[model samples]
Target: MEFLQPTSWTDALAAKAASPEAVPICGGTDLMVELNFDARRPAALLDLTKVADLAQWDIDDGSVRLGAGVSYARIITELSARLPGLAMAARTVGSPQIRNRGTVGGNLGTASPAGDAHPPLLAAAATVEAASVRGTRLIGIDEFFTGVKRNALAADELIAAVRIPLPVGPEQFSKIGTRNAMVIAVAAFAVALQPARKLVRTGIGSAAPTPRRAPAAEQFLAGALAEHDLWESRAELPGPLLDRFGDLVTAAAAPIDDVRGTAAYRLHALGVMARRTLAWAWRQYQSASPEGS
Candidate 1:
């Protein structure tokens, strides 16, 4: 096997466009596991860590642009203020070592449905920028994942960056696993409220073939908020609304029984996670107000 180290994005793009079958590695968190398990053996490896551009990030014009190779640790430490939902999800990722090495690119590149990053990214309505020798294109989070362990990225394309509109309000992420840290999610969920847009978006993971949004639930919540004027005047969220929202989120998942968990349990957990995450986000919003503070 051959190894190619790219010093720049252009170099990586050129290499990828030329050798589309080469395995692209930034941190090797997921790819190495496949390699160690004899599940994958590529003819070549395109190492992307040397490309500095892929590890840098910036915030501008109401959006956060995260370089593909930016580590989960950076996301938690450097970007938590700007992207709290993603940061919270990042904290729930593997161990400290894994967090320092594992990146957003690898998380999306593997495209595992249970990946913790997806739900937050989905809730944030992120867009993935991809480039190749051919050209560049932006793929929305909703359309990015085609199926389990699958994505819309072309073989010749490399993920350049991921852009997400800055959070305008409260957000939170939750996941249930067999154990606390370093464990894969049995069921995970993310909820974000965009006050400016009056949008309430929820993303469900592990309980589906791919991380997916609960559009109906989001619409329902958004409508409710609109009716109540987003509880702007110290009004609390009604318990009935919370229950309905949880039910709607549970209805969005399509899980199957597996060694990690059962379909019934996953559905139950999705409901609980949805309710808890929503409550947490709402608490954050309430705390942000002077009266509540």
Candidate 2:
């Protein structure tokens, strides 16, 4: 019913503390949908779009910090070169208009199990920065999402930014949907290689109640690569490893039969996307490697 746009963090926090129940709106991409359907209505809204400091972005000590108000359009255009997985996910989020208006904070705030950004952020092992009148706190992505459409944010808190540590190797992301674009993902995957440590982390979305790492698949791949000396050898990934990895990923998903997709279809698509993203990351890793020792 009432809107309060704050130009500074202090002002924002003051407004939030004043109205504890007031919804903090940044992009309004997800909240607008709920508002349109009359599913959510707050007595007041603390609009952070005009908060200048909340739109800042910077990279330090190999980690990138994106302001909560940063749009997908800026991410795709400005950060694509260094953070391809994030940019890829950002590109698939919604239409150009939506991307221009949507903020990463909104995506995290919504905390949908199938949100496009979650898998990539999970694979990147990102951290979220939240602030209130009291102080700031950094929470890991793994601990952020509590359940379906649920989060750990306090009523007086506002997401300040998202921080992602740089990967030591190539990363790739892919999603499966009924259509090419502008559709919700049935299954999404993000894979990253940490060659320095001979480690690989994979994140899967839409298949589980929350985006999570495919630990079994990751351990399996690590063992397979080591067995073939692929960790140090230039040998290509074995076909069996690929197949087994896909199967393991598929098994890890806890999908349900929903109107958007059948459980069986989601399971099938999880494997497909995993294989494709892994293969893509492997190729990029190989290409980035030096000519020879």
Candidate 3:
């Protein structure tokens, strides 16, 4: 296959716009696997790693803009202070070697429901920024994932960056995999306690056609927290409320039996994960440290 490396995003977009069929590659952690398995063979590739702009990041005004080429390693080390949930999810992505190359943007390019980064981004209420010859557009996380292995990105558009507002309180992520490292999740979940808004955001992965937020669970928790004034206190979430939160999260899932896990088991695991992550995040919220200390 012919490889075309562009030094800048403008050049890269022009190249992709000219050859919309050319596979756009950044880290190649995902694309290379498909190529090696003979699942795909594009005539050409648009390699964006050489573009300096796509590898840079900016943090300002309680928001972070991560470039498409920002690897899992960078997110874990540099962004952990600002995006603890994403950093925690990044830690579980793959091995050290895989993390060095694999990127959140690569996950966006593939749009796999099993991707570890998806749930955290969704829980953060992040935005995916995409650009093409036509121009740039920002898509909300809820609208980004349309179906299994699909996203809102168009054929000629490339992922430019992801924008996330800083978590106001504590956030957490959890997953159940057959094996911990380097294994796809049987079911994974992320929860972010937004104290400023008195909102709870939950993202369910692997057990859905697309990674999605558990809106019912979020609404339920929000009402309970507001009633109890838990957002400002050290009090624990009530047992009954926690149980119902897990049930609501489980109800939002539509899983299929696969080699990794059964649909029934996946639903059960989602409930457990949702409960655990919410408890952990609440504990973090109670901590004196605003940085989840």
Candidate 4:
């Protein structure tokens, strides 16, 4: 296979437009495996490491624009405070070496249902920045995934960055795996409490065809919190409300029996994680004073 290395963003875009079949490679964490296993043999490999724009990140307005090539390690160290839920999820990605190389952009590109980054991104309501010689456009995280191992990216477009809004309150992420590190998730869940907007968003992974937000659960919990003035009172989350929220999260999934786990186990794990994460996030929200919030 041919390898093309472009040092500038413009050059990269030109190269991609010229060779639509060329696969872009940043960390190569996922793409290398596919190549090694003969699972994919693309016409060309577009090496993006030298493209400086794709490896940088900055906060713009009220959002953090994370470049596609930024490593998991950077997210943990540099962005932890701003993007806690993503940092927490990043910590669980493979090992130290893998974390040093793997990236959220790669996770989105792979579009794996079990990808650790997806849940947090979904929960954070992140957006994917897609670019080409034609122009650039933003794809909502909810609409980015098309199917198992599929995404909405056009043939000529490359993921430029992910834009995640600054957190308004607490966020939490949890996953069930055979082992603590380096193992794929059996199921994963994330919750973010956006008190300023009176929103409670959730994300579920490994229990669905695509990483997805628990909209029904979010609506139920948000409405419940509003009904009780819990958002302002910082009241303890009611057990029954938490239970119903978990049930709704479980209901959103459409898992199947696979080598890693059974559908029933995934469903059970999702419910447990949902309740636990929501509880943890709520406690964090409660502990912070309104000014701190």
Best by lDDT: 4
RMSD of 4: 0.7
Error of 1 at 153 (Å): 0.5
Q: What tens digits encode model 1's per-residue C-alpha lDDT throughout 1-293?
A: 89999898889999998899998998999999999999999999999999999999998678898999999999999999889999999999999999999999999999999999999999999999988999989999999999989999998999989998888888899999989999999999999987666788889999999999999999999899889876565367899999999999999999999999999999999999998999898888877854432
**All candidates' lDDT scores?**
0.91, 0.87, 0.91, 0.94
RMSD (Å) per prediction: 1.7, 1.6, 1.6, 0.7
Model 3 CA lDDT for position 85: 91
Off by over 4 Å in 2: 291-293
Q: Which 10 consecutive residues of model 3 have the lowest summed lDDT? A: 284-293
How many collisions per candidate?
Answer: 0, 0, 0, 0
Instruction: Give candidate 3's error at residue 237 in angstroms.
Output: 1.5
Model 1: lDDT of residue 247: 96
| Model 1 TM-score (2 dp) | 0.97
Once superposed on the true structure, which residue ranges of model 4 sit more than 4 Å away at CA? none
TM-score of each: 0.97, 0.96, 0.97, 0.99
Clash pairs for candidate 2: none
